[model samples]
Target: MCEANAYLIEGDDKNLIMEAVDTIEPDGDNLLICNIFGEQKVVKASIHSLSLVDHKIYLKG
Candidate 1:
């Protein structure tokens, strides 16, 4: 279904911030997101890198 999950990294801890994300867009030190159910969310953080492998979104710092 091409559904993606968003995760936020905190030191040595990782947290699942959002799920069923339709897409992700970076804006400065934040992220603009559109969810599967047609919901929008904004996260304030610094994005290190973005990759898609096997239809999964990996946010790494």
Candidate 2:
């Protein structure tokens, strides 16, 4: 329940990258995101901002 949704921000647009993200780890130059359901993703992006109240994690590539 404490998990957050991940978003990829580009310009003025924000795109949903992952949902119910449980963990995020650094993997070389990329980032590894894991969901509550065991789904995983590797994104070549950097963290932009976090909206804890909204449970959102924003990233920029």
Each candidate structure's TM-score, on Cα atoms with residue i matched to residue i, is 0.67, 0.95
Clashes of each: 0, 0
Worst 10 residues of 1 by lDDT: 49-58
Over the full model, what C-alpha lDDT does candidate 2 score relative to the true structure?
0.94
Clashes of 1: 0
Report the Cα lDDT for residue 27, model 1: 77
lDDT of each: 0.70, 0.94
Pairs with backbone N, CA or C atoms under 3 Å apart (clashes), candidate 2: none
lDDT of 1 by residue, 1-58 (tens): 7776777777886677777878778877778878889888778865554444543454
**Model 1 compared with the native: what TM-score?**
0.67
Query: Candidate 1: lDDT of 50?
Result: 49
